[model samples]
Target: MRTQVAIIGSGPSGLLLGQLLTDAGIDNVILERATQDYVLGRIRAGVLEEGMAGMLDEAGAGARMRREGLPHDGFDLTFSARHHRIDLFGLTGKHVIVYGQTEVTRDLMDRRAQTGGVTVYEAANVQPRDFDGAQPYVTYEQDGIEHRLYCDFIAGCDGYHGPSRKAVEGRGLETFERVYPFGWLGIVADVPPVSHELIYSNHPRGFALCSMRSNTRSRYYVQCALDEKVEEWPDERFWDEIRRRLPTETAEKMTTGPSIEKSIAPLRSFVAEPMRFGRLFLVGDAAHIVPPTGAKGLNLAASDVRYLFDGVREHYAEKSDAGIDVYSQRALRRVWKAERFSWWMTNTMHCFPEQGAFGQRIQEAELDYLAGSVAASTSLAENYVGLPY
Candidate 1:
């Protein structure tokens, strides 16, 4: 098989990249190691940043989102029992859509399947070989048979652990990494959201977020110790912790049943240099990972694909590889910004006594300042709702 571009991983980044390329009259193939159902069912990031709704809508995948997606102009910042709302649209004229990556993936998949312009190879392994030369091949298996796919270029949207980055090992790529002392235990429930807007709570106990997916489905997150076991913090214990962090009036009537999904994700930050190695390029989580506090994971992926498509277009249209050439630097600017925001939000909201008495005081001061100053509150709200694109 041969294509102009071969995208690894069918996650949002890869799938959106393929769609962009297809829209531009470029042929591409997508390879994923997971079954289609698994990819579509995976529970992941749910917040779409300000400009993301517009970007995806223009890309021909926003019809369903426009029809049924939830929108919020701002979110609530809760400390103790007090709630302060920061109007994101009022402050920055931008607002986020409360939607899940799963739905985005499903919509893209449905459109791609119907158009028949994008070829998705599920349960396939893409091994990029001879990238330094003109033709690169991704070898994989299908229906118990081995096959080789040839493409002019490869997009390593496969994510942090996929083969794309491994293929670029020893290529002098600069890397940065940071792992926090805590992680988030997330849950998706079939309950109506307790608040009309999302609530980000900072309590002596830990950090908690109350966001919803739909009128009937809600999403929530709570900070947990790094080594906390899923078995130890069962549903009952989970709700107990949630109640402690939520606002008074909301918590009194809040109800949760068995979760449709639950999991713990380590809070960490990582970024790779250049976002490209010869004909292979990385986009989204493959190039960067942000702590979810800022709600940037999915938006960053979409932004990276925009850059990747522009680079590919430059290569074909202008006969210049400059766009692809600076892909990493361009994406990293926003990546690091979100990284800083995520780190700041995490450190500010969560109690970090382990860092020392000074650390605890600093966190408290941040909370106080955010609550006291309208300017500071607006800054935090704008970033939380999302910065520009």
Candidate 2:
């Protein structure tokens, strides 16, 4: 019925926050609307920025990642039939790990099960009640029964549509958002990746990415009309687009299997200001979201959890609320920086279908600037490598 902290949504943020609190000898409960299987099985982002990997490693949850995850020190940027590899480690002394979100969730859940440090209430509908009051509770329906979980504070780790965001809608929070005209059609194919390193291609056809989820399983994405449907893209059509963007000379032959999964995710950047409402704090997608271009969704969520854990630990450890008081403002500074980086990367690499010749020329000029100037290239590499946590 009561605890030191109650977390809504069992996504990365909530789960990681719970784990951190548990490690600090704090009691917390996590509520999720989806089944445990769904949360652990769903495919999501795979790129882990350098700092993110270090954080997970320090948290003692990087075992599986160390075994199966691919480590990349650089990625190729292709434009005008030229390939320029940004040496991530050489330029910034950083590296990224290619591990799917599914794997990260599984690792955390496994740790929770073994240590008994977290109470995961899955397959439940969670509603935030009395966030402004000293005593707040999360009411949820589980197995046809309603349960009210009261706690000292609530951490909203839920995604965009979760109940936590709407719970404080009347508090006059500032919202900033931008929706793109295109979406990415992403898929996981049962084949080896065409390239050893991730490739970001700028072609006349459109924007395409070549990445690997694992040694045998590969992930790929292509820009399409925002309203495009799955039914409109057949197997042949998908391969055709990949070939056009990758070009035969540089890309290996893709052996098509049954398209395992497909999704059309609209490109957008979103932020909700003042991520705190009384004792209910918002982190991760519940607070802000960046498009997949910069691969910041899961990493940002992890970073937010780190911040929240530090703040909450200080609050309880030292009998001081100073850390918790400034949590939102501190988190927002990093959030806005990521937002800008993601938006800039998306626009710079992806060409609009309706872009005129002048627009094309401008993009070319930008790429040229990045490629020609060591200063500009280093800046790109630093931002792409990631900022300190």
Candidate 3:
């Protein structure tokens, strides 16, 4: 097999990249270790930055999102038992859309299929080879038959644990990571959200986020011990706990229902420097991960794709390597800023049992200042809407 680019994942990042490339008349193929159902089965938070939404529009996949996604001009931040609204659009002149990540991937997948792009699902042991030199290729197995895909370049969009990053180990690749002591215990239920907009609640109990996938379907989360289990959190207990964290009035309005999905995710900040490795480039989760506190996970991946797609386009259209040359530099500058924001938000909103009372008081002071100061609130609003590409 031969292609211009070989992508090693079928997740949102990989699918988005593949769609952009196909639209640009660049031939690309995707290789996935899992089936299509498995890729779409993974539910994720969907807070779309304007830039990311525009990319979907560019790829001809934004119709569904624009039709069904919820647009928000602002979100509420609750601390000290009071609610302060951060007017995202008022401060930054930009707003975000609440669309599930699964839906975005589905749209991209549908677009890819419509365009007749190739994706090899259930590919076994996919390996990227000879990326350090010109003319890189990939090898994988399917149905007991081995095959090789020759491509001009390789995109390591396979995510954190995928073979692309593993392939570059010990070759001057550096990684930085911070694993949080707690995780987010989240549940998805078909209940009307208490508020039209998201609420970030900071209580003595912990941090709780009241978010929704749509007007009728809600997704909620609360901070929990890293070792907490999903099975241990029955619907009734989970509902009671979240209610305790929210404001009294807001809690009274919240509707409760059985969760269709429940899971716990450890919060962490991780980055792999120098996203480029010769003919190979790491994209999205392959390069970095931010705690979901700031809702930057999928949006960050889109930003990475934006940089990489531009670089790749320049390489082909103008025969210039300039964009590709600085791909790592450009992506990391944005990545670090996002990491800082997520880290700061996480530290501010979450209760650190380790920090005791002093820390709690300090956090309350920070939240108080954020609510009272226009400059501080503007900063929060700006970051929440997303920093410019």
Candidate 4:
């Protein structure tokens, strides 16, 4: 098979790119190593930055999101047994949409199907070949047959563990990574959320986040040791721990239920420099990863797709290489800012193992200042609403 672009990975990043390109009359195909059901089954963060919501609209996958996604102008931050609200919309004139990543993927996949775009699921041993040279192609095995896809360019939209990033090995690429000493034990339950908007709390024990996927489905997380296992946390124990971390009022109103999904996700901040090499471009987690503290992972992926789509569109529409030429620089600029924000959020909200009492005092002071000062609140609001694209 031959195409204009071959996108490796059918996650949101790859699928969004395919949708944009296909809508623009450019031909592309997506390849995934997992079945569609498995892909959608993975639970992920739901906070949607303003820019990401806009991109979904551009891809013609916004109707359901706009209809069902909850819009929030503010979120609560609890510290010192008090609740402080960050008026995101009031301070930044922008708001976020609380739409699950799963829903976003479904919308994009449905749109892709309706538009007649091709996505190959369960593709095995998928590899990008000859990306550095002009005639780039991808190879993979499917159903006992070896298949080759010739393309003008290859998009590595695969995640961190995927082959896309590794393909750039031996090339002059630098990587920066910091793995946190802790993880977040998250649970999804069928109960009304304790609060209307998300609440991020810092207590003597640990950090906790109260979030929701919908009106009746709550998603919550509590920081845990890196060595902690999901099996160690039963539903009752998880709820008890969550309540201990929240403010008294909020905790009193919280509803408890059997967890439908539970897992522990390690925290890490990783970035690969020069998101492009020859004809291959790294998009989303293939290029960078941020801790979920600030909810930047999925939004960063969408922004990367936006930058890449702009460059690709420019290349095809105007026969101009200028956009693609500067794609790496443009994308990296935004990537670094997000990395900094996510790192800062993690440091401020979580209790570091080595952060002695002095560090704890400083964290408390910072939170107090952030709650009392309009400037500090605005800064938080702006970053939470998302930096401009």
Q: Is candidate 3 or candidate 4 better by lDDT?
A: 3
TM-score of each: 0.95, 0.96, 0.99, 0.99
Candidate 4 regions off by >4 Å? none
Q: Which ten residues in a row have the lowest lDDT in candidate 1?
A: 117-126
**Residue pairs clashing, model 3:** none
Top lDDT hit: 3
Q: What are the per-residue Cα lDDT tens digits for candidate 3 across 1-389? A: 99999999999999999999999999999999999999999999999999999999999999999999999999999987899999999889999999999999999999999999999999999999999899899999999999999999899999889999999999889999999999999999999998999999999999999999999999999999998899899999999999999989999999999999999999899999899999899999999999999999899999999999999999999999999999999999999999999999999999886889889999999999999899999999888888999
Candidate 4 local distance difference test against the native: 0.94
TM-score of 1: 0.95
Question: What is the Cα root-mean-square deviation between model 3 and the actual structure?
Answer: 0.7
lDDT of 2 by residue, 242-292 (tens): 778875676656666667888888989999989989899999999898989
> What is residue 131's positional error in candidate 1, in angstroms?
1.9
Query: Which stretches of candidate 1 lie above 4 Å from their native place?
Result: 356-358
How high is the CA lDDT of each candidate model? 0.83, 0.84, 0.95, 0.94
Model 4 over residues 316-389: C-alpha lDDT tens digits?
Answer: 99999888989899999999999999999999999899987888788889999999899999988888889998
Evaluated against the true structure, the overall lDDT of model 2 is 0.84
Q: Give the per-residue lDDT of model 1 (tens digit) for 1-389.
A: 78999888998888788887887888898889988888987888778875677767766899999888888888888875778777888877778888888999988887777767655556466688888788887888878788888999988988889888888878887789988888899898998888878888887788899888898898988998888887787788888899998777878978788888888888888988868777888888888888888888898888888787999988888899898888878888878888899888888777664856677667767777777887997877777766664
What local lDDT does model 2 show for residue 113?
72
Clashing pairs in 2: none
